[model samples]
Structure formats: structure tokens, C-alpha cells
Target: MSYKRVIRFIVFIALCVQAKQMVAQNANTRPNIIYIMSDDHAYQAISAYGYGLNHTPNIDKLAEQGVLFNRAFVTNSICGPSRAVMLTGKHSHVNGFKDNHSTFDGSQQTVAKLLHNNGYTTAVIGKWHLISDPQGFDYWNVVPGQGEYYNPDFIENGVKKRVPGYITNITTDFAINWLDSRDKSKPFFLMYQQKAPHRNWMPEEKYYHLFDSTQFPVPANYFDDYQTRTKAAHEQAMEVARDMHDAYDLKLAFDLPKDQQKGLAGNWQGIYNRLTPEEKKKWEAAYGPSIEAFKKANLSGKELAIWKYQRYMRDYLRCVQSVDDNVGRLMEYLKANGLDKNTIIIYTSDQGFYLGEHGWFDKRFMYEESFRTPLIVKWPGVTNKKIASNSMVQNLDFAETILDMAGLPIPADMQGKSFVPVLKGKKKGDVHEALYYHFYENQEHKVAKHIGVRTDRYKLIYFYENNEWEMYDLKKDKSEMKNVYNDPSYSKVKSMMQKKLMELKKQYNDPVPVVTPQI
Candidate 1:
């Protein structure tokens, strides 16, 4: 060959070899991310969080191999808004999904879309309450609305279909199936969410007998008189005694007349309608006797309230039991396939729930029970094993952290700071001086519209509709039973917190405003 031709050929071969090596290096460095989330999962329920309500061996295993964020929280402590904040790395107002009533604008930029655009494969499987078609995912199979615990319907790549079997197990099955079938050439991001342990808690047939023998003690404030608080405390309809339904929540007295079926029964009926004859047989075998015996008890007053608490705890824990079991199955799959070493696994919830705390069962208030959610992360090589961090991270920071872990540049428009450094134990102190929260949905649940800020020691809330303010010294009043906003000793503390709350509101570009009108 001529000298000139030989020189050109050599250069081309060198370029080809360099490109191949770069691709291999990228594949080796980029970790696969699997984010597992559940709806209304209270941090207190997790044994790892030390609340001691239930044992979640599989989730606890993640904490053993990684660090747990003890002070994790949500920007907006509700379902859709929380998820929206996580996706966009911004607060609800900025993301345009302010509450459950707001719809997510899919055309906007999201972490998933950003990752996909930057050469990663993305998928979201399980509960999606945003009420819009997923835009960024390469694959999506989500349960419609608040999905049924049994035989739920899922929208797979826009095709609606009901899959038989328990929803949690079924969702996990789809997740593992995706992992097995994904294009291994590129790193994958799978949002493996679950619809379990939400409202109308229904345990899998196998888990129906799980928590039956356990007698849960009622919370200390289960009979909270709302004496120290304002109208908001007394007005909410989420109290376990007043809100939990007969046929729906407790799965009792289904044989009673339709008129006698206290509260809403639609959720229960939906679960029942989906069960096959064989599944029904197994379910009845487990719960039938309990239902009959409860009717015979004719319990009342304090006895009835305590019974309801025990029943709620048992059912909630049973659902959690199934979740833990399915999580173990996912962990086993990852380990057996030798994919555990390079994967970053995360476990969190949409928001926290009330397990008879303050006699309440739902979330939305700025109380600690609904405000603080558990955040456990395990990144095989990156995370410090078994270490726990007290840094105040939020659902707002989740997107930025995921992007940073994946070695992508966080968008400037995103309002949250990446907590990857905190995860690695390189940083100290709270992520921010304070975390800001705004709850817009009001009047329906009797929860007044409010905005608040929580610091490491104290919390200050402004109930604008009622023109009331509440301040608490968290160290002393962990239950938040006392509102020290007007206390003489805390007057200075309240002023400082109030200023900080407004500063945060301005920093986030959500200035003080009038409360949203009641729906």
C-alpha cells in the first residue's frame, strides 16, 4: 500500500479502539439505579426507623448495607405533589403539580427525561398518581389512580390491563422482568413503586394471618382532646375513631345492611370484586372468623377506640409484611444475577401516614407524623455501610442526588441541592438551615391551609386561613402536643423561625400569599 493510505488507515484504527475503550469505561462507572417507593408509608412503621411498629427485615437489610437519613422529609406532604417535587427537583408551585388536584405537565423537564436524554434507559412501574402520560420513561406500567391491593389494573405502555394476584408482588414481578429484559449496553433507571399499605389496607391472602396474634398498644395521644391546638386540630376528619370505616377500613361486618356499612365501602367492594373464587376462599378462611367474632363483641367507648387502633395496626402491618416479603424477592433477584454490586437502591415513601398518632389515620397536616418519612439508600461502593445521617434532606433533593450519583450535571433551574456528599459522609450539618413546606388542600379534611418551616430543633407553622401560628420545641415536645407560638419563653425563637420561613419562601420563589380557596 502507498505510504499516505497506510497512514490514514492507522489513524482510523486508533480512533475506533479509543471509542470502544471509552464506551466500556462509561458502562463500568455508571451505576444502575432502582428507586423503590410506597404510598403513605409512615417512617414510624419501619423497625429500622426505631418506631417499633413492625419488622421489615428486607428493608432493614438495605439499612445494614448503607446509610439511613434520620431527618428526611417532604416538601409537600401529600401523594401527587410529593412525587412531582421529587421528579423535578423543585417545590410544588414551581413544578405546577401543587396538590392532588393538580395534573403533572409531562412536557416539562424531569430527572427521568434528563437521564434518558443523556444515554440512560428509564422505566417507571407501579403506582403513578400524576394523572398524565409518563413522558421521560422508555418503558412505563403504572397502576391507575390509588390502585387496588388485589388484582389491580395497570396501564402498561398506555395499554390498560388487570393482572391477577396481589398488586405488590405483581408490581415487583414486572420490575424484575424489566431488569432481565433491559438493554444491558446502557445503564437503567427503574422506579419500582408499590401501591400497598395505602388506604383500605388489604393484605395478601398468604399474609392475612400475619399480624392477627399481635396486640398493638394504642398511641399515647390516641385520645388527643385538641386542647392545646386551634380549630385545625379539632376539625380534621382523619381521627381513627371517627374516620375508619366498618366494611371498608377494618374489613368487618360486610354482611350488615348497606346502610349500616359505616363510611365508604367502595374500596372494599373493589377488592372483593377482583378476587377469583379460589382467592376468595383463601381470604374468607383467614378473616371470616375475625369478622364474626368482632360483631359478637359489641365493644363501645374507650374499648371500641382501642379495638379499632389494634385492628388498624394489624391490617397496616400485614400489608407492610407483604411489601417486605416482595422486597426480599427483589433483593434475591439482584444478588443471584450478580447485579447488586454496582446498583444504587433507594427505599422511601410518597409521604408519611398516621397510624393512630393523635387519633388520626390520614396525612396532610404539618404534624411530625405526616411530615417526616423514612429515607434509606444503598449504593454498594459509594455509601458508608450501616451509618446513619441526621442531615435534613427532603423529597425535593431526591432528583438532584440521583443525577449526581449518575455523574450527570444537575440543572440550574432545579431548586434542591444534591445530598450525595452527605450520603458519602463528607458533609455535616443540615442540608439547609430549614426545610420549607406548603399544604394547599384545605377545608375538605378540615386541615386548614398552612405554610411552615422545620429546623433541626424547632418548627413554626402559619395557618393563614385561620390567622394562627404554632411553634414547637421538637426536643421536648416530640409529639407536638403543645403550641408554644404565644409562650413568652419562645417569643424570640418564634420570631427567628418566622423570619426563616419567609426567607425560605422567597428563596424558593414562592412568596407569602393568600390561602387557596376551599374546593
Candidate 2:
């Protein structure tokens, strides 16, 4: 054997070993991430939560295959602020977006920026409602704000493309396309946001006629007079019929007088022009059959409101249908590309929405309907598919969980504790004995500023704006119909929870309960 040849062969083997090590190192470096956010979606609306009014087979399947957290909540009940919280892992105040009207300070450390710094490709598609344009994402395409359902304009990689398609389906398309074209060498993180069931409730053509005749059962508190609840049923502005007449003008007939229905000062097109030609045709088809069916059915005024409830529920669910269809497609795409095992797919909304639970249509109240979001995660590590954890989770935990699961560093500013332990079906962080909720209400509906804490058995809400309080024993009265705030028996419970709320405020740096309204 030649000594020179032996040395050359040994060197070649060493070089190969180094190259293989580098490849393995890269594989062990980071994981691909996808996070989807939907607007005005509720835990009740999803079949995964098991209320069972609508069919969300895909989202439900995600839960069946992965971990479904029963008690996920948003920091703020609104869109922009909630998103900011999710990104920064900080509260609305810390994130510099107290409300939807405020701007997002992206300079603060974020999950996207952290992932980007950690050498993962990141992208956000659909519904970037932040006052400033997005940052840290390698690629971004988002709707302007409360984006149009038809002929929506999207700011793509750079250029703007106005496409005539529903926002839900189109947003998923953008996300899936980005995933398909992402750098194969590096793992990626994608935020797929959707603009559906937000406002004016526009559904796709195929879904327009969905459940046109079926009667959706009336909510338990459907005819609630707002007797006990000052704000719960007092929102005359957001009601289906009243807003249709006054604020929204949905009640105005095509030939109605200009001043009354059209509004003499403002643009009338806003009321009539929201619908595209295709959408108009579908609207007629959808309402036409239902209205005629009503005439023959001969429902009186009270029965008529019941009919209206059914119609409204149907439209909202149909909009959800489009969202569900795309989720199915995205899941299918993962299988086709063999990205299923490597990918972590999640389905959730910006906040839990009200779906006629308490005769309510919008989300803002600290009630369970509006506060708790339905979260389903399908990660590759979990062995059990249909596992349900009663452990309480909140929106704050999201940013921490994502970073923690990725084996990345979470910033000091993040207020949320990581639920990665809960996801793996292990209790690492404290399994929430009581969760705090504070919604400083300032919006179209005008709910009041309130703070509350939810223990496993008791729920306490203190109305700071009005100095009133409400408490419920969730175990006894899950519907929260009977408020035991004034009951003499619960005084001790109320004080105990109030003390807990103060502790939470100190912990989270939330405002101390001031008697006088700061505003």
C-alpha cells in the first residue's frame, strides 16, 4: 500500500465526515412554524368545542389529532391589540397597542423577529391590522384593514395585487404558496391570518344559500331585556335589527328615502356598495328563498325575530365554512408535500366571538362566550390524538409556547407563561387555578371597563367603570344567568377573589382599581 494514497483516503473520509456533520447540524437547528389567526371567530362556532351547531370537520380533526386546550383566552378581546400581544408576548400596554386605533411598535422583541434572528424564514399573510406596516417577516401580504371580502387588494411580496376572491380562501392560498416556495434548507414560520365573519358578514357564493331554511335554536337568553345585566343586553347599537335601522342602515330598502336610509351627508354607497355583482346575486338568492319561506310560514313579530336569529347564525356559519374548507386544503397539502410530520398546525381566532349565546352577536364582554378562544394544535410529538386538557390556557401563553417549542429564547418582556408543558400533556408551568381578565371597553358597542378572575369554581367580575360587580359559581350555573354579586352568602368569596385580582394587577402591571375613571 502506498502511504501517500492511504493518507489521501483518510483525508477524504474526514472531509466527508465534516460535511455530514454540517448537514445534521442544520437539521437540528430549527423547526418550521405556521400560526393562523381568524377574525371574530368563537369557540362555540367551532365543532371542536362541541357546541355542535356548525360542522368544522377540519378544525375538529386538528383537535382530534392533537392537543385541544379548553380555556385559551386573549389578552384583549379586540383584533389589533390581541395580535400585538401574541407577537410580543406582552400585554397591550407593553406592546404599545392598547386598542385597535393605536399603532404597533414592532421594535419591541417579537416571536417573528426572534425566529428570524434564530435563522428561520418567517412570513405573515392576510390581515395585518397594525397601524404601521409589518416588520421582521421575510415576506408579507396583508389586507389593508377590515379588508373587503370580494376583489380584495393584497400587498404581496412588494407589489399590490387586487384579486377577485373571498379573503379566507385567498389568505390560505397565499400561506400555502409561501410554504411551497420557502427556502428548503432553512425552516420557516408562517402566520396565516384570515378576514372573515368580521363585519357586514359577507359569505362566499357557494355558502350564501347554506342552511337557508333550517331554524337555529334561540339562545338561552335570546329575549334578554338587559334587566339584570346593564351592558350585556344593553348594547342597542350592535343589535341585529336596531343597527340595521340606525347605525348600519341594513334595514333601508333600495327605494327608501335618501335622508332616512341613504343618509343625506355621508356616502350612500357604503351601505349599498359593499356587495360585488356576484355577491349581490348570491345575496338575492340567499335572502330571497328565506324571506319567501317566512311569508308562507307566517311567523309573527316575535317568531320573526327568531327567524332573523336563524338567518344571522346561518350566514355567519357559512362564512366559517369557507375558513374550514381552506384548513382542509392546507392539511391535505401538508400530506402531499410530506410536511405533515415536520409541521405544527394550529387553528384559532383572534378572540372568542359571541354566537347568540346570550342574545349577543359581538365580542367584548368578559363573559366566557367572548373571552375564551378555541385552540387546537396538531404537533408531531404528541402520541395521543384526541386528548383534551381542562388546563386553562390564554393568548399570552402562545408567544411563549411557540418560542419554547422551537427551542428558542423568549424575551423578558413577555408576560405569558409557556404552555409547552401542557401541550406535551405534562404540567410544567402552574396549571391556571385562576385566570385574570380585564377589558377596557372602548368600541362601537361601548361595553364598560371591567376586571375579573376565574377560579375553577367561581368567576368574579368587577365593573370599574360603574363600580358594580358580578360573580358566578360556574359549577352551579354555567350559563352565568344568576349573578350572586349582591348575595350576602358570597361576600367572603367576592373579597377573596377581589384580593386575588389585585395580586394579578401587581403581577401583570395592570392598572390598580381606581374609583374615579381615569378617562
| Tens-digit lDDT string for candidate 2 (170-202) | 888888888888776677788988898776566
Clash list (residue pairs), candidate 1: none
Query: In model 2, how many backbone clashes occur?
Result: 0
For model 2, give the 10-residue run with minimal summed lDDT.
246-255
Best by lDDT: 1
lDDT of each: 0.87, 0.75
Runs in model 1 deviating more than 4 A are 1-21, 255-263, 511-519
| lDDT (Cα, tens digit) per residue for candidate 1, span 24-120 | 6776679989999988888888889997778999999999989898989998888999999999999998999987888899999999999999878
Q: Candidate 1, which ten residues in sequence have the lowest lDDT sum?
A: 510-519
The true-structure Cα RMSD of candidate 2 reads: 4.2
* Model 2 whole-model lDDT (C-alpha atoms): 0.75
State which candidate has the highest TM-score: 1
